[model samples]
Target: MTEVLQDLAEYIEQKRSDCVISWGFTNGELNISVAPSNITSFVEFLRSDSRCKFSTLVDITGVDYPDRTKRFDVVYHLLSMYQNHRIRLKVSIRESEAIHSIVSVHPSANWFEREVFDMFGILFRDHPDLRRILTDYGFQGFPLRKDFPTTGYNEVRYDEVQKKVVYEPVSLTQEYRQFDFMSPWEGAEYIISDDEAEGSKLMDGSKGFKDTLTSEQKIRNFNINFGPQHPAAHGVLRLVLELDGEIVERCDPHIGLLHRGTEKLMESRTYLQNLPYFDRLDYVAPMNQEHAWCLAIEKLTKVNVPRRASLIRVLYSEIGRILNHLLNVTTQAMDVGALTPPLWGFEEREKLMVFYERACGARLHAAYFRPGGVHQDLPDDLLKDIANWAEEFPAVLQDIDELLTENRIFKQRNVDIGIVSEDDIQKFGFSGVMVRGSGLAWDLRRAQPYECYDEFDFKVPIGKNGDCYDRYLVRMEEMRQSLSIIKQAIQKLLDEPGDILARGKITPPKRAEMKGSMEALIHHFKLYTEGFHVPEGEIYACVEAPKGEFGVYLVSDGSNKPYRAKLRAPGYLHLQAMDHMASGHQLADVAAIIGTMDIVFGEIDR
Candidate 1:
């Protein structure tokens, strides 16, 4: 591994010449810092070079440093499926300068670049149709910038006179007692000025919710809003479709309706407080999201978890995967016409939800995972329930197979529909079942094992075709594999019964210890009030989430809170392929395509 990274560093430096500013290996990954001018050519080399086949664009985001002259640092993460290697490229650019867009090279940078533009106000030159993706129309300043206020410049309220929601200058109804006879909402005079509001349009390139075609051209292609509120969209996704008769000519997805500023909120809170925020990302599989965050923080802090905790994490993660897959398959079947799958699927999901509630107090937003380990150990009876469920799940799965596996109506609607190719998977950065359904045996658990995954024996399912039916088959097979893993994990838990959390300053004292000992009480207070600080560095940790590769890119500045927290949600990337996948197919197939992709807008719009 070291030799390969050394070779890659030497090869890049030797080929790129002065473009390579610096390079090094950290956390078993290669990082290359380059000039902004050479980013396009460098990424192309990484994609095409035989020695470095970093074909997959995992994620692209920006970090804002208001103190530096080059205030914005654009970071691009790439993965090599052939070699099982990863690399990160960073380029520091001034706020005034524009970084070259890699859309011409990767094509998947279409929405990622727009997100960076929307969040950090960084411009990407030559980006086709660059617009605000995760923000409202005519939004003010960049929300992710360091100088931006947490409460924002304006707040929306329903005006009694206007009879509609209107944006007004932010005002505080009551001040917190912590302030020294001053309100947190003070000094808003500067932000509420007319100049800044007017200057906000400097970056507004989109035609604000208007007609794209002239009256004469409208006859050929007309536009319709599919939903920010449509039943078929699954969530709060709003797709603007330009159609000719029954065929969709163009589809533009307008998300961010559920924008909660999760990343910025993570930066404001301590490390422990950020755990619950991830659960709200993909609410269906909250544990999977929290697992990625825990891995990233543990990697940076170099915390070692106990064997028991590892087994518990593996167990719940698999259960969460099955839970998520059940919902996807049943909902996909329901969208296509069959309704029985949902009834059977939700019944099983309720059982899993009970397991979640047994482990953690909450079912949907279970903040069970922590940096060192889990929030607490599982109950004694929970294992018995899971073991019994694993035994009976096969019969339930068989019922689903009998209903939809060969049903004529289900096959007619799904077979040979919304077909995606291997190239499509590579270009659009598809993972999970989307890539596996296309014959790519790339499960991260096997490819790059984490926690106790390497010790467990399991199979990675693959499909021959990349159609909707193939994707469904892949997910169903994956759930069976998950059940196998869960059984193994349950046995391991019984074999190894010990401490769940690692012994360190990071973990809080036990409730019994805190009640009796004064030292333990102080330790608990300090741990919660000022969270454990991590070493100054950056790391990108990922897990094979049910939807796809859910990753957390964290940078710590030796501070309690994360310097910059960016979530690389697979749903966001998968949703980008909707227009391409649904272009030629009839408009009715859009729902089936969306169902197969399994996008939860909570993660996509985050």
Candidate 2:
């Protein structure tokens, strides 16, 4: 690790020829954070420098710190495709200013930078067509900043004449948004009540409301709202597209309509309490989401899961991956006018969900994973069932291939639609099938092995065209790979029979005597009421989820609840590439492009 960092420092020094601000590693990966002014040169050097040919931009996200000297920090994660090394670049800027945009270096940074600008109010200098990418147009203030009110600045009224919604600024004299770090119910003070706003209206008539923009005024160049309702969109995501005929001049995705402020909510709940919320983040694959969070907490607390538990986690996670990818591909096919594939995909997925039910006792929102270990051990019958399904899944795959792989209409509609190049994948810091479809052999499970993935022998599939068809083919192949992993995991489980839950802090009392013994009852009550405390530290845990590298970066300050929890969702990155993919394509291909990206709005909105 020291040698790797030393080599990285030398690489950064050589690349930055002019000024190398700082270079180091955090949480085991190399990081070279440069000044805002030196960003372009630094990126160019990193891209061209043979030693550190960082060919892919993994992610670009903004962090707000109103109390700090540097008000905001824009972070970029870069990956070296050849070396299989990762680096993080952080550029700090004051609230009053904007930093130079890296979109020119990586076009996928375009939407990501726009998202920063939209949520945190960090301006990206020279960002071509920088606008609100997540929030609605005419949004009053940056939502992610510490000072920004959780409920937003004011109430918005629809202007019939203008055909748009307008925001009316309210008084800054009101109390700050109160967030309780103890429990979700205790955080009621932070919530905005309709009665309070209405009472304020009675006092001043116009004190709380302000007109920002009307629909007619906001509309330009063939603008249309895709959905806060359209089924083609996976969830309640609304996209306002500005088109010049069939060409998308500007594409702005309005998220947060389904905003439950999940991170904020999690910060108020105990580590155990937060597990259920992960299920909500990516409802389609709750197991993957829960596993990512569990891994993050487990890493921070230095808890070693038992061999049996690790194998069970892997088995469940792989099943979830297959289920998620199947649904995504099937739905995407349906969106592109191929209806039969979705039914075929769902049928297989339902079978997997049945297995999940046998294992976790729940299908969609399985709170199966817990810190230190899992909630319970897999039953012998369930194990046999999963093994049977694993054996039979290949036949189902062959049937799916026969149905869609050679179908002329499916091929014609998806072949060249939504072509995301290797450059775009790198720029957007895309992962999973999106990156694989672009020909990059980067997978978190392989690149940074977690759980018992290193023990499993499986292949990471890659695509050539970076098109929708490639994404479909890659996911189809991935399902088979996942089945192979599951089979291996089942074998391991049979070989290792032991306690599924670790015997230490945070372990639940045995169920056998809870009802009869007062001591066990009291223990259970204490565990649920107070929750286990974690050491003061932060850790970022990631897994190769079906959508992409679903990561949970958690900060724990020796509290029952988290200090802060951020989900590094891959769907957000894929959504950012929508414009680039659908720019010149026909309007009808928009659905095909969206389908190909396989974005679940739950992840995107969260």
lDDT winner:
1
Per-candidate TM-score against the hidden true structure: 0.89, 0.82
Question: What tens-digit string does per-residue lDDT give for candidate 2 at 267-324?
Answer: 6689999899889888888888999988887887778998899999999889888988
Per-residue alpha-carbon lDDT of model 1 for 1-606, expressed as tens digits? 878888889988999877799999777778889999989998998899998888889999999887899989999999889888899999999989999999988888888899999888899999998888887655656778877657655777799999999987665332211223333345433344677554434323222333467433223356678988877798999998877777888888888999988998989899998988989999999999999999998998889989899999999999999999999999999998888999999999999999999898888999998888998887668898899989999999999999999999999889888888888887999999999998899999999999989998999988888999999999999999999999999988887789889868889888898889999999899898988888889999999999999999999998999999999989888899888988978788888999999999889888
RMSD of each: 8.8, 11.3
User: After superposition on all CA atoms, how large is the RMSD of candidate 1?
Assistant: 8.8
Clashes of 1: 1
Pairs with backbone N, CA or C atoms under 3 Å apart (clashes), candidate 2? 57-426, 57-429, 58-429, 162-216, 163-215, 164-215, 168-210
Evaluate model 1: give its TM-score: 0.89
Weakest ten-residue segment in model 1 by summed lDDT = 173-182
For model 1, state the Cα shift of residue 279 in Å. Answer: 0.8
Task: Kindly report which residue stretches of model 1 are placed more than 4 angstroms away from their true locations once superposed.
Answer: 153-219
